[model samples]
Target: MSTTVAEVPDAHGPTPAGSDGEELPTRPTPRRSTLGQRMRREWQMHVFILPGVLFFSLFAYIPLLGNVVAFQDFSAFRGIFGSQWVGLQNFANLFTDDEVLRAVANTLIISLLQIAFVFPAPIILALFLNSLIGERIKRVIQTIVYLPHFISWVIVIAIWQKVLGGAGPVAELLDLLGMHGVNIMTDPDTFKVLVVSQVIWKDIGWGTIIFFAAIAAIPTELYESAATDGAGSWRRMWHITLPGLVPVISLLLILTVGNLLTVGFEQLQLQQPAVGADAAQVLDTFVYFRGIAGGDWGLSAAAGLLKGVIATLLVIAANRIAKRLGTGGIF
Candidate 1:
């Protein structure tokens, strides 16, 4: 009649049966806390995002409900509730509308230009900057370039107008060289090029920050190995640096495609009058004119909705293509 002791099993695993022909008791499993309990415990952290949540709910997500106006023959006086439901009439008109079609075409052209020129500008700049040996020179160059990104689109346009306009330095240089009246700012044929150039100048440095980070993340060992294997600077960069940037490049490309129709609302609207609808007039400007100026709110909403859907579809398609091509997508 020796005293008996209850042997508890280890928390990690159950133990074998004891000599007394009874299994050891296991430690009790921990119970999961309820959502309410977790929230209460993490209330302080939640407080930080409370304002952003409220702001988006009020200004972003909640207003999405107004998209219903796309279907209704909406009027300011009659209101969404009182407006007549015209079903798909507004959407149908979008395909038949010349203005909408023109906007779509221009948007597509500008989007292609941006992807070709603007998207890669940053990657090249980052590589060039990363190749620089002087940290001081690199810092100064980065500061100067990134400063333009903070400037307003209005100022950016103004700067470009001064440099490329009829009386700008470039025009004066052309005038001196017997190529008089070579103004690009007002030239419709070159307007798309101007837009793409402006985007590159402004955001290239900002975009490079990500690429520089990606390059930094590449293992120095790979570069050393490549160098030891008789690889030159270009060879190492091509094999190591370029591959490291693929994931980031693919992700940003997907996001850029999603905004395919956007093409900078402020930037395009400010230049549309100068270039006219033929060379400018993106989808955003079309919506502005139709909705606010022309008072065709329903048709405008329909066009807006249509563009949004197209952008969304493009993002999905681009992401799938990226994934299939072996680079990871944003999703």
Candidate 2:
């Protein structure tokens, strides 16, 4: 008598009795909505971002096309398209120009000073504010800090002038004390320091808002657990708070490095008369004076294009370093 055999599944379907038990592969179902259909479904979300998208396209991306002037003997009379192409001549001039090089050097020096001093001031302030037990006091302090950020640069500069200029209160105090009063506003040696101080005083509070928010977003449980384990305030901050702020810090650092060459056009331009271009000349002012005032369109455009390229590369390099360090980057 033959033994009863069980049916076995195979590649296609259930196999006949005594067949192998290999299973069939199933095909993935096609997605129900096409990309267009999906976009249409989320039309409102797209609408929400449309204005921002359009604004950048118009002001940022569109202006990028003008960089072609960097490669041409650009003339206002002939216009960008009518201008004769000069290949690398403009770039050559940019690199060889003494004023451009000087501007670049000044920009680097000022930017480094700002990064070293101004960058960390907000974080320190944020930490101090965060550590405060009284919410009402913290709110009042934050408001005071944030107010300067809302003040125009012109007004801020005026205030600084009134407080630290040759005849200002500090100088007056020095005069009363029988010490020599210094004109800080026009002193080239101290211009970089003045710029850094202004940046810290004006934007430090606004900068703290982000760091404070980041600190607030950190879970209280982490701090509570650390405290339960007998960790003191400094230990808790070092272990929990700073680690939580790494992502935000990394992001801001990347942005700061990327903008190393910028160094505040309006602020620098306004102060140039006081300190003179020898000390205050930066890439932005160089471009403004060379292109707008001196009518050296091609040269200025080349300088700007170079600055933009360097800034873009800095951002890329910074992001890469951040990723390697295991911190979240802007990318």
Candidate 3:
């Protein structure tokens, strides 16, 4: 055949591996750094947390050793080391003590009321605040609500006393209306209600901060799409916003449950003189009155230890329940 011009590979065509008579080298894998090396590299971060560690050790953790006094006939003169170990006698005494039992009942009652009423106050307020159309009005209202949180409880109690005490305006108005003025601050029958109300007013604004942040994190697109699909303000909030807040709400609820036995000591202590111990006594006040004020150190410690154990157990149970319900808890 008149030789057809032999087909030839283009000069720039792909070449097979080793076709050029050279082998490509493989890359070496990187080695992982040792723990020591990692620690050295992140040493600055360790330094930053060191002060917090020291502070907690000094003020929080180290003091835990004092809980041992619960089992001892502890004396200030003999000290923790030299004290007589009375075992569970102190605990037995706690169960038998009417004051302790009453304190427990009062604590549970107040805590339950707070959990039911005060806990939801912030959620409702945050939702209401977020729905405001005017930014200036919303901000002004937020400032007013937030101011009470910063004021000391002393001032807060005083303010409430001035507003609800027998000679206060509401009381005066009631008196003028034919119903005699009553001192709400000192009323045993309604002390629990007053406590819950004070707590709601004081912390609701501050508590809403987390919920508001949660609301902000929700994708704006969800609300816009919902609106485009004919959803109203309440519908958008109910469907989109409320679901976004479940996590924060669950976390706070679990924490609140954990603190069931520990009511506000200073708050109750201050009002106890006016309302009497039967209405105002709680676990915290029980401990204070028994241990420091009454010099029943062992009994106080036992009550404290029991409170701590129950709180820890409550946290664990709440965490488990939250996990089962599909909202993660603050473990």
Candidate 4:
């Protein structure tokens, strides 16, 4: 009889059947979980943020629905649901109103002045404080400066009036010296200066806290190395300190541009009567006087809506520009 030869299978050959001649099924790959399933799995993590989410939904987002008033001839009597739709009539009127135009102009000018002068005050103060050698003196100065920020606007205005008002100490001293005291409080030409100065004085120190923190984060080794290499104080600040601060400066610049139309409402409103509306009216004051006080609810709502839209656009544009310049932005 001839000997029978069994054939051997290659490594890449198809899977063999079992001894009983049955093929086993291959295991299926796992699929990703759906969003709902993921949310369920992470439910506990989300619970921590639930209160904040609810708060914003209630106060910030839900109230946005009220912007419908901008498109309607809104009436207090008829209410939001019952108001007659007027399309763009309110917005048309807003653009045509001379007082509204003037308010926009004043708002722009004051915002520009603040950006140019007041915005940098805090940075300068932070730099000065950071340069100090004594931590105790730095803490004391910081406390004194930050105190003004916590004071109420009413008290702040009152303090300003006492110091610079027509019959205040400066005026009294000027009278004794037979010299004319400058009327800073009521002068339209000087109102811009006064407002910017007040902002710097009130918030400069508080604003510096962030900058101080940024400066402190810089490694002392870098400064010591720079000094060892014969680099002067100004050179180190220019090369390292300012470069480190560029990201922060860029972020703040974008925010400042976004708020270019919103100079302090309370500050402007408090002093408006003293200097007259022509000198002090801003978008906020315009909304208050035209809407709440004057009862032209729809028109004022249109103005406010416009301001918000412009601010949003400004933020978007500024972020884009910052990105182009290679500075990271606040998204």
Candidate 5:
């Protein structure tokens, strides 16, 4: 009789207890690790990351626990642990508070203006810069434009105040011409426009860097191929350059949406004295007034938390829309 080795069963396979079959020892999965092994393998990377992890834990994570105060009537004397639970009282008050509502309205208005105007300025500036042939002139222009971004908001505000104030160069020039001086800094009607203009003037140059880098990254082969196909400069820019910028544009838009409410506390705070809270108050400055100045810690914390949650949702929705439209996402 010819018995085939293929008919033989392994010890790990099905076996009858009464047949004197021995149990096979199980082996660990190739990818499975004991905790000690994993720690030993990743220890170097963990060591490298420890400081950053510690800093975030200390500064960010630890402070997050204080958000519980938002749900309570927080008192400095009673401490966070001992506070009385208020259950939406702070949030309720936020809607009813005139200053808070005004701040919310002003914030939304300024943010929309920024989205419409400031967002496009950099890309346009970048395209202009990219088209310039002289490298030396390009570098000089880039340096001059980027200089404003490094200037402190205080100095920027001071300069603007000096220029647009009743006695500054612009106003002085108007005075010499026997024309009425425009006090734009204190005009509530033009506050949103002024803020948007300031954002463009201050950060537009620095913002161009990302778009310029994106423009530079476009393969020369694409433009060469387009040229071979009889495409003009305008056609190349329309077909290739703009499309190349879409990813960066989408990313920045999503980030901007996420940070819509965070229009620089110091900038508005400095301007508020001139424009008054009604005109200059945004959500950030509102938080500062309530939390730091007014000492209504719970109310301010709730407002801030709400704003953050809204911003996060906006970013997520924007990313989803971008992905559906066939653009690269932040993820």
Candidate 6:
């Protein structure tokens, strides 16, 4: 007697029956891992993100908790928990202070000036450089310009002091020419000019990188096609290069608006004594002087909190405006 094997049918779907008319064997259902097992599988990815998560939590979120100091009369002797709650007193102090108003005024004036003068400079510079024929020379010039960005603000200011301060080279030249030696470094009258110029010198090169990158990303075929259509370098740039950079420009503009009040704390702080708070007082410096230096923690924290809130709103408004204007927004 010969025996025959009969296959069982698959449970998921129909399958061919055996000669004995039995169904084929079905595949087993797949089982999902538990939450713990799933987490274990992604352990490497979690490890990679852990350090950054810790850093942000410590440096960013932890400090944000200190903003509570704005609501309390904070003192070293009386810690955060021990401080007396003063509700809106700190905020009130900010509104009533004349120096706070002056600081805000100075910050806005200088930042707007920077936006007007310094912002578009790199775009122009990049375009000019892009139009040049020699790649090696372009690279060399880019490197030279970008070098200043790496220099510390302290050193940058010191160098400016040497060049523009009284008895320095520029002042000495003016003195020798029978002109009154004006102290650019310590002069309240010229502080805005000095700060703006320093900002341009330090950042213009760094800013050029983005514009240059944007310009470079434009297709060579576009330029070739434009040339075929009787377009010159200037024409091609006007039509192609500038349009390509519009997105980046718009994005940076929005960001700059957000940072308008963030006019250099260290820069102003370093120069404040020489130029006096009247000329050099920006919001950041005011916070440092009043909060950290003078030990008025509550008032400083309140002022800082207000500044941050305003800056955030400005960024949101700028982003919305950009989107409405048909430009890419930061979000």
Clashing pairs in 5: none
The sequence of per-residue lDDT tens digits that candidate 3 reaches over residues 1-37 is 5878866757776553466777545557899999999
Tell me the TM-score of model 3: 0.90
lDDT: worst 10-residue window of model 2:
15-24
TM-score of 4: 0.89
lDDT value for candidate 4? 0.91
Alpha carbon lDDT at 93, candidate 6: 86
If ranked by TM-score, best first, what sequence of candidates would result? 1, 2, 3, 4, 5, 6
Kindly report which residue stretches of model 6 are placed more than 4 angstroms away from their true locations once superposed.
Answer: 1-41
Q: What TM-score fits each model?
A: 0.92, 0.91, 0.90, 0.89, 0.88, 0.87
Worst 10 residues of 6 by lDDT: 7-16
Give the alpha-carbon lDDT of every model: 0.92, 0.92, 0.92, 0.91, 0.89, 0.91
lDDT of 5 by residue, 243-317 (tens): 999999999999999988888788889889887888999899988888888899999999999998899999999
Candidate 5: TM-score?
Answer: 0.88
lDDT of 2 at 252: 96
In candidate 1 the C-alpha lDDT for residue 138 amounts to 99
lDDT of 3 at 193: 92
Least well predicted 10-residue stretch by lDDT in candidate 5: 15-24
**Model 6 agreement with the true structure over 1-331: per-residue lDDT tens digits:** 9999886657865776678989877678899889899779999988999999999999998899999999999997989999999999989988789999999999999999999998888988899899889999999999998999999999998999899888799998888889886788988998898888898899888999898778878889999999999999889989999999999999999999999889988888899999898999989998988988999999999989999999999999999999999997999
Alpha-carbon runs more than 4 Å astray in model 3:
1-34
Pairs of residues clashing in candidate 4: none
The deviation in Å at residue 197 for candidate 3 is 0.4
RMSD of each: 4.6, 3.5, 5.8, 5.6, 5.5, 6.6
Query: Once model 3 is optimally superposed onto the true structure by TM-score, how far is the C-alpha of residue 236 displaced, in angstroms?
Result: 0.7
